[model samples]
Structures are given as structure tokens and as C-alpha cells.
Target chain A: MEYETPLFFHVMRYAVRADRDVIDMVSGNPDWEPPEALREGLREYADLESSEFQYPPSDGLLELREEIAARRGVDRDQVVVTNGAGEANYLAMARALERDRGSEVLLTDPVYPYYPGKTTLLGGSQRFVAAGEDGQLDPERVREAASTDTSCLVVNTPNNPTGAVYPEETMRELVAVAEEYDAILLSDEVYDHYDLSGTFASALGVESENRIVTDSVSKTLAITGFRVGYAVFPHDLAEEAKSRHMLINVAGSRPAQYAVLDALRETDPAYHEANRELLAERVETFTGALEAAGAEYTRPDGAFYVMARFEGYPGTLENVEALIDDIGVAGMPGEAFGDSRSDWLRFALVTPRVEEAAERLAERFG
Target chain B: MEYETPLFFHVMRYAVRADRDVIDMVSGNPDWEPPEALREGLREYADLESSEFQYPPSDGLLELREEIAARRGVDRDQVVVTNGAGEANYLAMARALERDRGSEVLLTDPVYPYYPGKTTLLGGSQRFVAAGEDGQLDPERVREAASTDTSCLVVNTPNNPTGAVYPEETMRELVAVAEEYDAILLSDEVYDHYDLSGTFASALGVESENRIVTDSVSKTLAITGFRVGYAVFPHDLAEEAKSRHMLINVAGSRPAQYAVLDALRETDPAYHEANRELLAERVETFTGALEAAGAEYTRPDGAFYVMARFEGYPGTLENVEALIDDIGVAGMPGEAFGDSRSDWLRFALVTPRVEEAAERLAERFG
Candidate 1:
């Protein structure tokens, strides 16, 4: 029942609370504020006494669904609002498993930890396909992992920990594989807006029935705590997904939904541009420090994270604690993610004072 | 998959929209604005920077937890914030089932329909014990329902559909049943503040180890759509419950949480007193109209609902729809609640125009 992210974060908080100069490079939080327009929308929505404060339609508010449809280029009926992408992913898996018992969920090795965690929690078996050394998921590996028992496959693009964005061709091939196996594809596109390569891809763009897209305003709007997210499914499965979502968590927050709807309608393009620039700059600064420290790491094309391998530092629980205690920084061990190599560690470059954090790391490891 | 309440209310809305004169006695919504102090507190909290929108501590905001603990007279570690009382009840049952596979969930007959729906969805078995003809649950009947296979028992005092509040002796007997069977007591006390009989009771006040209380500000503050609720559990199960709650929905809304905290701290006593008085008056007016119409019904002791039985008219789907279509009044048929021989219908006196509604009903039924 314990969540690894919060548990690790709590440990780090306790480790550094007394130290004023401690740097937090552990959480995958975006160190930016939502656009001014979004904030104003929240203010306006909060002022009005309307049905927004009452129980919303079980599916979702229409305007929010329309906005998602407009942005994702899908029919409004294809989408369902969820608590967050996490819950959406969980619902998709649960629905798929319920529809076909004794089914397995396929995951890419070094996947976003939640995928496997949710799979286990839902009483489904998981099969992992190793990503190449470049941290990219190859279509052939996925095809090899697919089986008649595989009912669902979770794919996170511009992925967490690795930051590998699947190319259009790769996604098309993967969709073909899912079609061949008759499996549901659960695409976690929560980090869609953070594609630094300027080449974002979505499985929903493909013409296929075996796809469910999960995304949230957390990363895009810098409002993770608001917990407003959604899933897009084929018309045939949308009802089941919606039902499971409601049964699991009655509905998302009333005010937060209004705020998210406002954020989407009013936020300017320049706000996203500014956020992208800030994140790109921080990623460069931190990766440069990692290089100066003689660390081997994958420079992410997107997201505010990079996985680095330090000499003689096998990613273990003991080493993780040492890094926090001795270096005054916190990062996730790759071992916690999957059955992959144990020499890598995940660092989040989401601190506002990126330059200072880089300097501190350089002083300790350079 | 579809929720009966929302669907029923939607049909009621369609009828209301078709004719503005139609009286809505179907929705369990409260008819009062949030306390002014709470609204102001929300405005103040909303003005804070977007950092407050970041991912919440998986458990919940510590301030809200402390407030709930102080109010419930429980230890701070015993409280967990959930999406709503619905989600709290859902998660509590899920946790119990996880602890004991294929657990049986015992519910009072004519109980809140959500309990049975959620339990069935969670893959748990449900057993029902009939409450007395007075619309009150009998302790001996509940004791008889408890068995070795019973993993959890759900009790809603100040109950829904039927406004029967469990007295102290009845609650004590139920607690003994739970303790004897080693089963968890899942108490839904969302309507705790709406007690018109001046007999406010809580399972937490009874000092039971096998009890969890689910309550929300929705009813008290008249913000049913805000979707903010909490569950207070014994210390032994607090961590598991907190983790499962967060895993399911992450956390409740930031602004809503801050608003409830402010409401709990600053809302004047007179505001609540006035609300109670208004509801009490409506109950009296509506009951008088029903009596004049020659309907047989039990007087509500608490909550904003009254269940009435009509002579020569068994409560059926046809009758409920006829009342809406011809009589221009909407109510829930008793069949949806449980299998009972009594021909009854439920009316929610939560609207401001209850007097006019009563007059409209009297015109048709009398």
C-alpha cells in the first residue's frame, strides 16, 4: 500500500530539513507557476456560486471534455476525466483485466515505476521488455514481449527517468503490434507538453481501436496537487473506464476541475514557451555538472530528469542514503524502477536555483 | 456502470426544465451557501502562488488532518482526506477486502445504495439486515447478521433515504457485534451535522478499535460538488488507509482543503444554527403537507429527507414517474433502496422553495 515516491521524498525531507543549503533533485515536479491567465481563471471560478461546486456529471463536465477533444483531436465521447493520469492508467488496466481474466500487462524495462506497481496491485502479471542502451524502446522488443495472454501494454513517451520520446514511426509500429496481439495500449502522455525536441507524438493520432491515452494538467499547468487528469479510450471501452474511475475515486475535485478548465481556455502560448525554455536551460546546466563530475548519463531531450551512472556506485538502498547524507542531494535509484542495471540513478533538474545546485554537485563530485 | 442517483436527478432536471413549476424533491443536495468566513478563507488561499498546486503530500495536507483529528477527538495520525464520503467508504471496503480475500460486507437494508454498488464493484459479497418499520436499525438484527465471514459492516447514522439516526445504545450494540466478529465498522457520518433531534452521535466518540468514520463538508457547507471528505481510522490501520487513499486518488483539492480548514476554524456558530433551523422548518412544513394529503410516513429525526407511503399506491417505477410527469413532483421510489413490503417514496426537503413544493404535492395527492 505504500507509495515509493512519497516515502522516498519523506525520507529526503527528514534528512535535509535541518540543513539550509540542501538541494532537492529528487522529485519530478515542475519548478514553475501556472500561467497568469490560468490563475485568474481559478480566481474567477472560485468567486462564482454555480454547479461547479456540486457533483459534476459522472463522466465529466462537457466544456472540459470538449477542450480535451479539441486539443487531442479526438471525439468528445472518447475521453473520460480522471483523478490524475495515475488513476487513468490504473482504470485502464483494471478494465482490461476485468474484461479478460488471467491477462498480463507488458511494460518496457526501466519503465515509469507506477506501471508495474499498478499492475501488481491490480492482480495482473507483468512482462518487461528491455529498452536499448540508449534508453529507447524498440518496436521489435515489444512485439517479442507480446503474447496472447497480454491484455494491456503501458507506454510512457518522453518517458520518466529516461526521457525517451517515441518517434512517430516507432509508435505506429508499436500500435501495429498491439493490433496484432489484440491488446489495449495504455499511453501515459502526462509529459506531452514537455517535448524538448519539438516533435511530440500521441498514440491517439493513430487510427486504432486498441489505445487508451492518459494525460494530466499537472506537468503542463504546473498543478499536480490539483489532481485533474483524464483518459481517452475507444468508444467501446470508454463506459467501462468511466465506471471504474468513479468506483475507485468518486470524482476529481470540484474547484480544481473548474480551475483546470479555466487554465486550458485562458492560458497563452507564450506561457508554455517560457516554461520550456526554463526547463531546457536547467537540464543543460545539470547535465553539464554531471559531465564535469565524470559521470556517464543520458542527456534527456525532454522532461526535467536524466539518469546517470557514477563509477563504483551501484544503485542500492545504502548508496542512495549515502548520496543524501554525504552529497546533500537526493535522487532515485534505478533499481526501484525495474529489473535493470543497478549502476544508474535518476536526478530531477527541477530546482529553480539550477546553477547553484550544479555548482554544489560539482564541488562534491568534480 | 451508470450511477442511479445522477441519472435520476438528470431525469428530474429535464422535467424541471420542461416546466418551471415542477417541484424537485428528489436530490439530496443541501440548500445553503458556505459560511461567509469559509468563502473568504478560500479567496485568501486562492491568492497564494501556484506552488500550492504542486503534488500534495500523498497522505494529505497536515493542517487539514490536524483539524479533522481535533474535531473528531482522535489522534492526528488517524485521519485521511479523501475525494468524498463516497470514496472514503469505497477505499475502506477495498482495504478490508484486500486484508481478507472474498470478504463479506454487511449493510443495513434500506441503506445508502452507494454502499452496495461500491461493494459489488470491488468484488465483495454483500449481506443485508432489515431496519425496523420505524426506519430505525435494530441492534439485535445487526448482531444476527454478523458472521465469521463478515469482514466489514457499513452503518450510516443520520442515514440517507431514511432519516433514522442510530441511538447510543444501538451504536454500542453494533460496536459489540463488530468486536465479537472481529470485523471492521465502516461508518458514514456525512450527515452528522444535520441532526434535527439534537442527538448528535459519532462512532469515534464510542472508543471502538474496529471503526472508521467517513464524513464530509459537502452536506454541512452545501457544497456537494466540492468533493472533499475524510476518513478517521484507528491508529493501527492509519498508515495503510492513508497510503491506499492516496494511491487511489492522490489527494483532495488544494483550495477546497484550505477552504474547509478555514470554515472549521472561523465559521460562526450562528451560521450553522440558522441552517439547522431552516431545515427543521422545511421538514415540518413538508410533513404537514404530506399528512394533509393523507399519506402514511415516518417523521424525520435528522437529515433533510422524509419517506412517505401512500394508501392504495405501491411505490413502483410507474408511480414515481407519474408523480413527476403528472403531479409535477419528483421523488425516489423505495424499491431502489431495498426489498421491503412498504410502499414508500423518499423526498428531499433541501430546496429553498420547500413550502411551494409541499403545496404542489398536496394539490395533486390530496
Candidate 2:
């Protein structure tokens, strides 16, 4: 019941410490400036009165929660500001299992690794339903995999590793599946702002008491280290989630939340659009190189990752290491995601060296 | 079972939103200036390069952990920088419970309410052992209350409600009891810096594999909102705790850690000494008023709280509310802690209004 693999940071650290020149495509930390107002907020916080440095409300700062609620079109009481989307998902999943409906958690194959790790940590059994090759999860497939014993079905849109944006109909059917099974639909939309398809739909859009949409300013504002994120829960679940959040971390960093609130209030939407365009360009460059290398790859619809499969190069720890040592480019081994994507490698196109890493992969694999 | 009482914030908020001129003695937030270097660190962080805003090492910033390790005399690997001592305690308790030895968690009565709340959240059954009237836990009492079925024993010192600082002999015997039961001892020493008594000892000094020390900069630096804390574990427990922390929170706030680390390195011991001296004065003033009022009370050995029992005025929610409404003062109801201290009210002396609050109580009750 332990995590089957070391976390992404392990591989990332190895790549980072390698003596050879390595272009990191392994980590998801965005290589872009955060909203200017975030830094401005930090500077301003330094001058605040001493009491301001004391604990914020255990749930979160009222203004930050209010902002998140307003932006997501949910009641302020429904939002539980978490340490990050990491804790948001954790709380959502924990609450789901706490309901006594079921202990079985439904996840996607080629999934975000943290989901399963969290399931094990929370003492829930995990069952993975494989998504299609295009990283698309068929609602029927999920429905078939779930049961009354399934406590929750977790999905990420504008997703990680595969970067598939679930469409409105798919989201609706998924919600229906959850409703039918009496399971919570825990939707992680941390990458919502990075949608390139212009069709990303939130589980929030599909109204249901069972839906919990978890998001963070980490990706949108390029401040993962800030650790300010929240979950929008059904009213029944919000109080418990906030209480759990309080017991877990007391609350997130107040200065971080303050900075994020300031940034949220002042930053223009154009800033997000500009970052999306930058990712779009990087995606094109990286995928074109995959094509030139004659490798099959998923052209991501959103987020900034591309999964590529090279012939005779089944993704494995050895191969991942060889790529790092020999070609000087680092990517996550597909096997790390789950068995379904075991033959592919996932590259995060978040670094400025995306084009350079693409060229290295093209030359080596071709 | 659910938490028996609402969290401290609920009461704090009630007092905050109260229309009366209540002198707040309920919340433990320190009313003092944090080291100036902390603010300087935040200002400097606002200008750091973009990559610095990405995730620090998931456990924590290496520099911060290293600083903590050096100061605490533990190996760097033994430290897992957490969201606060809150999460540090959570991970330590979780790891102890996960050992599969038992599910019963031993806690002190008149406990910090959050301890029992956390035990419940973690799905462990809780058993409370009452301390002496003076707020001192007799190790023999804890040994008598515990069994082989106990997974962990949690203690806070310089305690929250009672403010008892365990002497070395007590801590050593407590460690022995934990060893005998094959249970982990989770020590929350967030108030270590607030210790006014020269005799205050850390469980870390007791030296047992069963011991895990949880601490935070929140109380020490008077920056609870910074949310930077850590756990020091035996080597065997460190990796799993770090992994759990990563899943719970990708990492704590980098800027917060940076600021704390700066303050840790730059702030003089005299600053802490000054704060302690200030608290010592406040404690004397508050206790004199309690004596004048002819109320029974515990003179705290360390930390900044006083538990007082007024004649014909048992600590209850209604009584606490009446205090806020009629006497224009707020102190936490003793019933909120546990069964043993139900007749007493706990006042946090960490406020500038201690003199005013003391006068109000003396005039009304004397």
C-alpha cells in the first residue's frame, strides 16, 4: 500500500544534479514571471502591523476566499482555501471516503501519480480506468469502472502528462456517472487558465452536489511555491473540509494568500492570455519535433505537457536515466503515470529550454 | 466522532465581531513584533528571479531546513519542514498510527482542543489523561492511562491551556513509557521560545527513537500566518513523513520560509529574551489580579496562558459570552479543553491589553 514509485522530485533532483548539461522537461514549475502584483503584495505585507503577521482565519483569508468564490461563481462558504491544489484534492478525496459510501477510489490510468499516493495515504483502495490514447476519458469507460462502492472519481481537465481538456458533454456524463453511483466527482482544474482548445469545461459548470472542483493560483499565476489554492465544495462538505484544513496546516501562508489576493484583484486577464499563447507556441514547437523524430505523440489541447512514444524505447527508469545521461534532456518515464502509458515518456514544456530539449530529442531519437 | 467544540478561531471571531469593547484574552496569537529581518527577507524575496517562485524542495527550502537542523543539532535529513507544527504533528501522528501497532491515541486532558480534533480527523480513538491541578502531567499517570493498544502519545509544552513545562525527569519517563508501549511520542514544542522557566526541556533531549519533536516559527517569531514549521524524526520515520508532507502540501510557502530563515539567522537572542521578559511581566500582573479577585488559578511555569476559576462562575460557553458582553473581556471556556478543566477559564496573556483585562476582572470579581 506504499506509493509504487518515488515522487517526481526524486527523478527531477537526479536530473538536476547530473554532471552533464540537462534541459529539464521533468518538473512542472513554470518558467515565467508571476503576476507583478504578487511581488508588490509581498513588499506591501512587510510594512503591515505586527498583528497582521499572526494567523489568518484557519479556513483562509476572507478576502481571498471571497475572491475565489466570486471568480468561480460559487458561494463564499463553499470555498476552503487549502495549502495548494495538492491539499485541496486531498481534502476532497478524504471527505469523499469519509462519507462511508465506499472506500474504492476511481482514478484514470496514465493518471497524476499524486492521486493514487493520496488514496493510499488516506487508506482508500484505488482502481484505475484507462483513458483513450488521446488522453480522453470516456464517460462510459469511467461508469463501467465505478460502482456503489466507489467513494469518488477524480479527474483533471486541461490535464497533466497528457494535457487533455474534457469537453462539456464528457463532463456532464461524468457528473451523471458520479451521481448515479453516489460518488463525489473531484475535479482538479488547476490548469484551467492554460487551456489551448478554448473548450475546457469545469465540473462546476455541471451542477451537482457531488462535484468538488479544486484549483490553485499556482499554475495560473506561476507561483507554485506560494501554496495558495482552494476547493469549491458542496455546502454540506465545506465546514468539515475547512475544519480538516485547519487541523492539517492551521492555514496556508498568510503572506502568500495576501499576495495572491492582491494579484487576483489587480492582475489583468490579458496576462493569463499572454501566458497561454506562450505555452501554445512551445507546444507547437515540441510536438513538431516529436513528429520529425517519427515518434507518436499526443498534441496537447491544454496544459504544457506532451506524451511521446519512441519505437524500441519503451519508457522505463533506465531509459529515462539514459535520456538524461546521454541526450542531456529529462522527462518523466511514462510507467510512472500508470501501466497504460508505460511505453511513452511525458515531457513538461514549462521550461524556456523546451525548443532546445525538443531538438535534442529529435536528433537522438531520429 | 466529530470535534466536540468549534475551533479557536470561531470563538476568536465571535469575540472579534462582538459589539462590546472586549479585551481579547481567548486567542493565543502573540501581540509582539517579529524580528525585523523577517520583513526584510520578504522585501528581498519580492525581487528574486522567477524560478525561485517555483516549488522549493517539496520537504522545504534546503536553506531553511539546514538552518533548522543546525540550530536543533539534528542531521539535515531528519528535518521535514512542514506547513507549521500543525502539519508536522499530523505527519508524525499519522506515521505512528500507520505503524499498525494500535489505533488509540493518548492525549492530555485540558489539552489544546486541536489535538483531540486531529486525533479524530486521523481516525484514531482518543483517551485523555488528566494533569495535576497545577497543569503538570505526572508520567506515572500517563503510563497508567496508556496501554499497548496506544499508537501514539501527544503532549504540548509549555502547554496551551495549562502552560506546564515538563522537566527533564518527566520528559525522560514519558519517553520511557512510550518505549514500553511501543508507541511514538509526538512532542509539540511550538512554544519552546516562549518558555519563561529555565527548567523547560524538550523531548528531543530525552533521546529516544519513539520521540518526534514538532515545532514552528509561528509562535517563536510571532508570525503564525507565515505557516513555516518542521518536525524532527528518527531516521526511520523521516522519509515517509517527508513523502506524506509532499502529498499533503507540495511544499510550504517559499517566501515564508525564506523570511523565517532570515529571521532565524539574523535575529539576536536578545529579541527573544526581551519578548519573554515582557510576557513574564504580563503574567505577574494578570496573576496578581486573579489573587486579588480570590480566584483559584495556576501560575504558569512557561508559555503565556493562565487558567483561573472564579467563585460561582464556572467556565461555560454562556459564561464566556457573558464575560464578553458584560465584563467586556473574552477568555476561552475551560470546557472546550476537556472534562478535567471544565470549571476553569483559560486566558492567553499574550496581548497588550493584559493590564486592562486584569483590572476588569479584579474590579468585577474582587
Against the true structure, what is every candidate's RMSD? Answer: 2.1, 1.2
Tens-place lDDT per residue, model 2, A138-211, is 99999999898999999999888889999999999999999998899999999999999999999999889999
Model 2 lDDT per residue over B112-161, tens place: 88888888888899998989888889999999988989999999989988
Q: Which ten residues in a row have the lowest lDDT in candidate 1 chain B?
A: B1-10
- lDDT for A295 (candidate 1): 82
Residue-level lDDT tens digits of model 1 in B278-366: 98898889889988988877687888888888777776667877777776778777777888734888888877778887787788778
Model 1, A235-336: lDDT tens digits are: 888877776666656667677787789889988888888888888888888889888988888888777788878888877767766777776677777787
lDDT against the true structure, per candidate, is 0.78, 0.90
B-chain TM-scores per prediction: 0.94, 0.98
TM-score of each: 0.96, 0.98
Pairs in steric clash, model 1: A54-B225, A55-B225, A225-B54
Best-fitting candidate, measured by DockQ?
Answer: 2
Q: What is the TM-score of chain B in candidate 1?
A: 0.94
Which residue pairs collide, candidate 2?
none
